[model samples]
Target: QVALRCGANDFGGTLMEENISRAAGAQYGVSLSVEEIRGIIREIGRIPKERNTLYEILE
Candidate 1:
């Protein structure tokens, strides 16, 4: 997760496809997409750059 923030990005979701492990519980909130993660990074005053799964620069 720290890598995501350092790369001007944010994590979207986990492969598990649920929020049960989070403090809010499974019924609270939904997962985010890549686009949403980008938006969040921007909102947090980051550049919001894209990267591949292997961490290669995309844009």
Candidate 2:
């Protein structure tokens, strides 16, 4: 959420686990659901999108 407000146009895909983050001392098993992601984006006044394998935004 902060990242979007801070000018992040793209977000990393939904992660099922946070292995690297855990190693870096971030909260363990960090994950967000699609609904949560959309809510966060909307909270920051932006729209959420899903990309296809070719990187095209899905409708």
Candidate 3:
């Protein structure tokens, strides 16, 4: 949230699994919906974009 407001534009991957994070006991979960992510991005006054593995926009 703060990051977006501070001019961060990248939001990383949407469908990728967080297996390494989970294995390390990060409790934020592994998956998030595109809608949910977009909502957060909008809440922070940034546009949400869906991208493919090669960083091409899908939405």
Candidate 4:
């Protein structure tokens, strides 16, 4: 929430099995579900956007 209020806007979805952070041993687990991400963003009064591979908005 602090990050969002401070103008940070790049939020990501679930990481795939071949994700880099997982390969690099990032132990972040099960905390970033889609609903959780949307809830977090909503707490700061910002709408969450779903984007495509080319960074185009999908929803």
Candidate 5:
């Protein structure tokens, strides 16, 4: 959340096997489910959208 206040805008989705962090031995989980991400964004009063590779909003 502090990162959001510091101007981090994009939160990546849960549609992939994000094992690179675990491969690097990080303690956190690899990814968040899409609904979880959306909830977090809404908790901070922000809108969440599903965007395409070209950054077009899909939802």
Candidate 6:
């Protein structure tokens, strides 16, 4: 998570439908919900911006 602390705007791959990371025993591999992501962004003192699958900002 250090990467996230270092000015990473978003947590990529959190909302993946088929999560291979979970199968590999990564507890934090679950897909993140929009609300969950928003909360995490807030906790890290940043605004949560929504984006589409193509990484386009969703207004």
* Model 3 Cα lDDT, one tens digit per residue, 1-59: 88677877765533555565566698866666768878988896677776787989885
Give the C-alpha miss distance for residue 5 in model 6, angstroms.
1.3
Model 1: per-residue lDDT, tens digit, 1-59? 45554762334345446554465565565667868866766676667665567877786
> How close is each model in CA RMSD to the real structure?
4.9, 2.3, 2.9, 3.3, 2.7, 3.2
Alpha-carbon runs more than 4 Å astray in model 6: 7-12, 16-20, 27-31
What count of clashes does model 5 give?
A: 0
- lDDT over C-alpha atoms for residue 30 of model 2: 66
- Between which residue pairs do clashes occur in model 4? none
lDDT of prediction 3: 0.70
User: Against the true structure, what is each candidate's TM-score?
Assistant: 0.43, 0.69, 0.59, 0.63, 0.65, 0.55
For candidate 2, the per-residue lDDT at 20 reads 59
Error of 2 at 27 (Å): 4.6
Query: Against the correct fold, how does model 5 do in TM-score?
Result: 0.65
Q: How much lDDT does each candidate structure score? A: 0.60, 0.72, 0.70, 0.72, 0.70, 0.70
After superposition, candidate 4 runs with Cα above 4 Å error: 12-30
What is the per-residue lDDT of model 5 for residues 3-54, given as tens digits with 9 covering 90 to 100? Answer: 6668877644334556657667988756667788778778888887887778
Reference-based TM-score, model 6: 0.55
What tens-digit string does per-residue lDDT give for candidate 4 at 1-59? 99789997765444344354565688754446778888999988899998876889986
Q: Rank the candidates by lDDT, best first.
A: 4, 2, 5, 3, 6, 1
Task: List model 2 lDDT by residue over 1-59, tens digit each.
Answer: 77677887655433334475677788765677779878888987888888776779989
Model 6, residue 15: distance off in Å is 4.0
